[model samples]
Target: MTERRPRKDAVRNRMAVLAAADALFNRRESPEDLTMADIAAAAGVGKATLFRAFGDRTGLLRALYEARLEPTMDAVKAGPPPLGPTTPPLARIPALLDALLCFKLDNRRLALALEGTAGAGPYRAANYERWHSLLKVMLEQIPGMADSDFIAHALLAATRADLVEHLAGQERVPPERMRTQLAAFTARVLGTRPTPGSNAED
Candidate 1:
């Protein structure tokens, strides 16, 4: 005997739930606090239907976060200058940092979630690695930077969620000071030897 397939209503309901979750999480920076009932309400379906569609919060967050972050880095890796290819190696490092700081400020929770290798599993790890790879490639293009890839990995580590939270959230450092420090630190690691031109000392 043949198995029965989901009806069109089931399919539409599933898509709507995913869409609602993605909008809430990605656009508004909502966390896994979103519930099946919330998704069902947003999707105009019942709670049981959302469970049947997404299984659990982890499953939905994983799928939706992957869908968002993977393409995000892709655009960063390919779009125009300052973010993508075609920017000068020296300028690109600081530019990337600026973009990243904005991203962190906007998606602070999701960025925090990616820090631990657990829970996120292999897929999130792969996304982190992708960000590292793009950064390393930009570094490698710089002249005399022999250990650019290794240096890029180090830069990535330095910009992690723990440090960002401590410095910005707890210490309450001013945004300009933070930007100057990050650019200086990143530039130093990449061996760019910053000029003493109007930046915070140390």
Candidate 2:
């Protein structure tokens, strides 16, 4: 039997739900403040429809997060240097961490909500494993880098959503400054000297 496609109306409703949820999540300080009912209302669909489209609140959040991450993930996978396959591992390592940090900063509340969910933290997420594996492979390519697996995990820890929130929200560190600090710290971890005039020190 041929696979049945989703109805056109179902596709439209799904898009509406995602767009509404994206807007609400972006405007709110915390995703915990929003609900499936709220999303359904915002999307002009029944709560049942929302649940049917996405199994639950966690599922919805995962879909939204994945949608937002897709472009960046694609770039990292196949785009130009610094994030693509062509960049030297040493350069790519720091670049990847920086990209992750920026992504966390941009999606602070959503990242926190998703990563802090019950029964499944950030480490359990598929994207987290993908990033860890990528970082580990790159670290392995660098001369004298030991324990690439542990090092990759350690490096990623610096960009955790909660940590980014703590530094950006509570501490009020400027975005550029936070990036600089992370770069400096990453350089130290890799035992590489920072580039001259690089804000890694600032």
Model 1 ranges off by over 4 Å: 1-15, 22-32, 46-56, 62-75, 114-124, 193-202
- In candidate 1 the C-alpha lDDT for residue 176 amounts to 71
What's the lDDT for residue 97 in model 1? 69
Model 2 clash number: 0
- Model 2, position 64: C-alpha lDDT score: 91
TM-score, every prediction: 0.68, 0.92
The numbered model that scores best in TM-score is 2
lDDT of candidates 1 onward, in order? 0.67, 0.89
Candidate 1, residues 61-163, lDDT tens digits: the string is 5555565655446656697876677778787777776667656655556556555433543324545677678778887787777786677777776667666
Cα RMSD to the true fold for all candidates: 5.3, 1.8
Judged by lDDT against the true structure, how good is candidate 1? 0.67
Deviation from native of the Cα of residue 45 in model 1, angstroms? 4.0
Worst 10 residues of 2 by lDDT: 193-202
